[model samples]
Target: MTLPFFVYGTLRPGEPNHDAFLRGRTRTERPARLTDAVLYDGPGYPYAVPEPGGVVHGDLITALPDAYAELLHALDALEEYVPGDPRSLYERIAREVIREPDETPVRAWVYLAAPSIATALRTGGTRIQTGDWHSRNR
Candidate 1:
């Protein structure tokens, strides 16, 4: 089954990873938002967490193969993309992504960054930008 990846960073369209994975690839991108979220500064990446009323903007991409999944995973070096890794951040799971008026809700495997990752790379600062990976260290 193709998987859904919850991407809040540069993996979005027109970004660096977009070309590698989404370039010329036919997939559904949904406008989904996460609430009470804070983006954290990881060693070389970013992670999200639920806050009181903080909302996060992201998308849910569907119909991706294992290879494509790996390609999408290459974007984050902070977590292990292996079949089983304790230090892994995002997990491949199915979730309901918010769909726009003209959008449709499709089932997909989403990669959720682990909370421990948030604690590990918690630098206390993350900014929201369209298609740019935010890192306090950067």
Candidate 2:
């Protein structure tokens, strides 16, 4: 079965990792949003955490079934998500992402920082109030 992914950081279009990881693997790609999630700067990357009134900007990409596993594995590695590892930098989870312009909701895989990491970021990391990694970094 094919799966969708909500990419907010390096995996978004034009980002350094996009071409390397998703360019030819996606069946569809469009702007999308994950509501109620705060974005924080993690040096070269961005981390997202669930929040009551936050909205994160990103892209929703559908991977072809034939490439899904490989794509997901590559993404997991890129996000440093080691399954069952407490020390993983991010946790891969399924969440509802709203497609942009129309606001249609779809289930998609998303990488989120652990609560403890998010709490630390809240205290010391730079917050991307706009929820746009590209804009904040640029």
Candidate 3:
């Protein structure tokens, strides 16, 4: 699928990996939120753990059509996501996110915490109360 991406952590603009991975590759990036998921702090990044009644704040990114395939492969590699790999750090899944302001729904690829990580996080991880990784420090 060549859908847009919903980035919530290091991949968001201004984050460390943004320029290296997303800069000119995306045609548009706007505020958006993923419902039914919560944000948690990872070693150096953040993870989105699916949870009932949860929400995560982030941006919805539209990749330039020509760059879609390359970007997809790069991102999957960056996230260490191999389809059906149990040990992967994250799993890329398609989910509906609500675009900011107008609240339009858009289907985008969201990198979520893999099963093992999600289990550990649920046991004893520090949740970002505001649901926004950028606001976690503040």
Query: What lDDT would each prediction earn against the true structure?
Result: 0.54, 0.90, 0.94
| TM-scores for candidates 1 onward, in order | 0.61, 0.95, 0.97
- Candidate 1 vs candidate 3: the TM-score winner is 3
For model 2, how does the per-residue alpha-carbon lDDT over 47-125 read when each residue is reduced to its tens digit?
Answer: 9998888999999999988899999889989998998898888998889999988989999899999767888997898
lDDT of 3 by residue, 9-52 (tens): 99999899999999899999999999999999888889999999
Candidate 1 residue spans exceeding 4 A from truth: 1-3, 64-79, 101-107, 121-138
Of models 2 and 3, which has the larger lDDT? 3
Superposition error at 67 for model 1 (Å): 7.9
Q: Better model by lDDT, 1 or 3? A: 3
Ranking by lDDT: 3, 2, 1
* Model 1: colliding residue pairs: 3-109, 4-109, 4-110, 36-51, 36-54, 89-114, 90-112
Query: How much does each candidate deviate from the true structure in C-alpha RMSD?
Result: 4.6, 1.2, 0.9
Best candidate per lDDT, number?
Answer: 3
lDDT of 1 at 39: 60
